[model samples]
Target: MISARNFLHFSRGVALAAAVCFFAATLAVAQTDALPSWNDTAPKQAIISFVEKVTKPDSADFVPEAERIAVFDNDGTLWVEHPIYTQLAFALDRVKSLAPQHPEWKETQPFKAVLEGDMKALAASGEKGLVELIMTTHAGMTTSDFQKIVIDWLASARDPKFKRPYTELVYQPMIELLAYLRANGFKTFIVSGGGVELMRPWAEKVYGIPPEQVVGSSIKTEFRMEDDTPTLFRLPEVNFIDDKAGKPVGINQQIGRRPIAAFGNSDGDLQMLQWTTMAGGPARLGVLIHHTDAAREYAYDRDTEFGRLDKALDAAAITGWTVVDMKADWKQVFKD
Candidate 1:
């Protein structure tokens, strides 16, 4: 028989041990659940099943280390793209910010629309206006300097609809998927049509992908000295446009290897999926994120001003691309 103090100490130790075990078990369960935030759907299930099959050793569908490449489009696929392109919105806002210094912009078409908050005129300018806006606001600065501007803007910029930072506007389900693939030895890359320089500033923090892993549309840049400090300055010339068929070209040029998995939302990403499938690799998967949740997010197809999804819709069934309906599949959208 032990003394009363010894008995009490032993009981306390036992309780602590039980508590630790319980906590650990709870944590393990939570972590397991974290990756499957999306509701049961063929696309979500397929994603999980593919990752498990490829990553598990001794599995018939096990993908080798060199071949475990997964690529994702950035804009509409990974985050929200509505009420006009968010990056374009950022560029317009930057144009407004600089209008005070560049008084000539007050009289210019796109710049005038930006300064006066004239959406009608802005839309009327169309792609040419958009190109001019991007060229004027995003270029003529060192890469590092532009990156800092992007970082600053994203930190302060809030989505007009959600009232959240642009960074926080990312899809919760996709983020989990990114983490899940990375955990299973898949090298996740952001093969976006958005500007490479724009995405580089925050992709690592937001998507867990480094700048090198992000391949996208690029503008010309030249090395120059400002105040005797040598830096790379962005030139107002398009080097590449990583959209539609350009997606595959950019991927091939940059990665030099076909990705085993491709995820995208719009027709801009259709060529990427095509390339992934047509390349003829083992156990390839192509997924398209269909925006169907109107309340949680704006939903439009074919007629939408930004990220039109018409062609991709028709191709989904014929090509076997899994179209994920956001309203049905996602248990949650933006992170709380």
Candidate 2:
């Protein structure tokens, strides 16, 4: 009962309306699916369940927005820490770059090992030798200078396996989890064993956690004025070590309030989980990221020297902490 022209226009309008409706539905699904990168497994469900209980008004586990503090370890928990800690890699590169300035490094046990790329010899250097490497490469510069050096190094630095910029190596699932928690009125902080200065420059851009919310191990610094500019000069001395027992102390000193949730991957984070979950004022959550994905990423637990997941892996059974099996729990490791 319509002209050909009228009928054609009407058909076009119908298609347009359908497209709009479809687009809206797709958007809604995306908005609701907070962790698309995560497999719809128990670990994903546990995270969602905890967030719901803590944020829901009628739930007994509901915590006020201010008290909903969540802490995360940076290295293995949030991003890749396999092969070696990213910071150590940076230090090794730095030792090489600075070799021309210090000729004695050619003969030094650790430095010589680093230059020769001898993993066994480097391991033999032990904790003292490792500390010496950290001090030699990390100190004797202003905080601003140190940050700039880190930023420059990160700009070109690529993971040995992925061959992608280190920043691009962050776990997509964890990034989604961070945004999900923040969207739910929970504050997030990165409590890492990595240097505070090293992370503060990039954490906000990389993880959405601002520099002020980053807490980590640090060296002693001296305030001095150079050419009328006030600067904090990093010294070759340890001020704090924010690992194991030190994590809780760092959190207490910096964050003040006890975190309601803690996420970590290694034994270094055991005390942090204990502090968050054991002090029973409210319902708390502890999560450990188990590196089980060998195909998509490196897999190491009991045997690895770096980012070893041993005691905490054992504790998760008794403490009831959610152990996220990376192979089974995460659908995607890195973002597209």
Question: TM-score winner among the candidates?
Answer: 2
- The local distance difference test score of each candidate is 0.88, 0.94
lDDT of 1 at 85: 73
**Local error of candidate 2 at 259, Å?**
0.5
Candidate 2 colliding pairs, count: 0
Tell me model 2's lDDT, rounded to 2 decimals: 0.94
Model 2 lDDT tens row, 1-336: 899999999999999999999999999867789898999999998999999999999999999999999999999988889788999999999999999998998898899999999989999989999999999999999998999999999998899999998889899999999999999999999999999998999999999999989999999999999899999999999999999999999999999999999999999999999999998766799999999889999889989888888998899999999999999999999988
Q: Which number leads on lDDT?
A: 2
TM-score of the candidate numbered 1?
A: 0.88
lDDT of 1 by residue, 1-336 (tens): 999999999999999999999999999867776456699878777887877787778888788877899999998888888876788879978987887899898888988988999989988999899899999888887899898998899888888888888888899999999998887788999998889988888899999999899999999999888799898989999999999999999999999999989999888988999988766645678999988889989787788878899998899889888899888889898888
